[model samples]
Target: MRFARTRRDPVEVNLTPLIDVVFLLLIFFMVSTTFETRQALELELPETTSGAAAEVSPVTLVVTAAGVYRLGERELTPAELASALAAEAEQAREHGLVVEADGRASHADVVRVLDQAGLQGIERVRIATTESRTGETISPQAETP
Candidate 1:
């Protein structure tokens, strides 16, 4: 008696589906990844016409029309404001001072602040103003603080 030999077929694996799934995952991750743009503190910066961008973090003083003064988030009296300015000036003379005065704030109050800043030997002082709807500086009468 003789036995017949059967035909053998080659085995194969299809990788097209696996490759497609991997490609879809790569695209999904790429599209879902978020990029951070800002890493510093947020501030409502005042606009200026001729002033160039500030390079250093200067001691900022905010004055309201009611003659209220603020250093950071805390309210400061005239004396405290002057002393703070002097201390900051002593720490880093290169870092100047910036004064943000409201439109209705009195000129006398601004002058007084300037005088205090000068007493602290802070020569580089600037006034903060917001831009108009037209994208131009609202033009505070005095260019410098």
Candidate 2:
């Protein structure tokens, strides 16, 4: 009778260990990764021919498509706006006003609001536009960021 020697081979790769390592790596990345969010400026801007007067956002006096002038929620006409601003001025030290008009709103209406707002002793008057977040309009009026 001849005696034969048996050779044993070792398994080179283990799937379970590999899967565990992969999951550990995924968890590490999930915990260690930092998420940075970029914030955009408020207001959706309307397209305009002159981009210079496009960037500015201040205390907005909104003019709707229906020609309703609003200082926030309160609707005011040209004369009413003057009175409202005058009232605001009497209560406060400095008067600042910004006029926001819809793209469809009449240009005359915006100018009229500005004119009336000025009469109320508001030194700072800006036309609100959705151009830049920092507010950079060219109306000789100081832009509020």
Candidate 3:
């Protein structure tokens, strides 16, 4: 009397479900993450209680606390700023000018920009300000000289 041996199938792990779960988690994290691009200049903008969103402008002038002027990413001197503003004014007269000055920047620097805008016949001017923590208004107004 002899006994016959039986063969069994090899055990296997189904990875499709594991792969699906991993992909779902990846998609969830990608959708929930936020990306912010910070400017090179560390500027603390002035806070305002009442402000309205400004229309998009073609020209943007940034003034640093150290009294440095920047047109776009390029730094410029006061004299160069005037000429640059003139050129921008020609193309952006309808869009107007947007000035972003550091909260600690001198009033004179902002005023000078305004004066140049006036000379270039760009009447529409806006100064950028952050909304107060308590309120949500982005108002840009010129201080009375």
Candidate 1 differs from the real structure by a C-alpha RMSD in angstroms, to one decimal, of 15.5
- lDDT by candidate, in order shown: 0.69, 0.62, 0.76
**TM-scores of the models, in the given order?**
0.53, 0.45, 0.57
Clashing pairs in 1: none
The sequence of per-residue lDDT tens digits that candidate 1 reaches over residues 1-145 is: 8889888888878999999999999999999999777543233445546644444344678899989898778897766777766667764347666777988999878888887877777666666667665444332323333
Q: Would you list the rank order by lDDT, best first? A: 3, 1, 2
TM-score ranking of the models: 3, 1, 2
Model 1 lDDT, residue 111, Cα: 83
Q: Could you tell me which 10 consecutive residues in candidate 2 have the lowest summed lDDT?
A: 136-145
Please write out the lDDT profile of model 3 over residues 8-83, one tens digit for every residue: 8889999999999999999999999987865342334546574667566768889999898998878988879888
**CA lDDT of 138 in candidate 3?**
54
Report the C-alpha displacement of residue 94, candidate 2, in angstroms. 2.1
- The runs of at least 3 residues in candidate 1 whose Cα sits more than 4 Å from the true structure, single-residue gaps closed, are 1-56, 134-145
Model 3: worst 10 consecutive residues (lDDT sum): 136-145
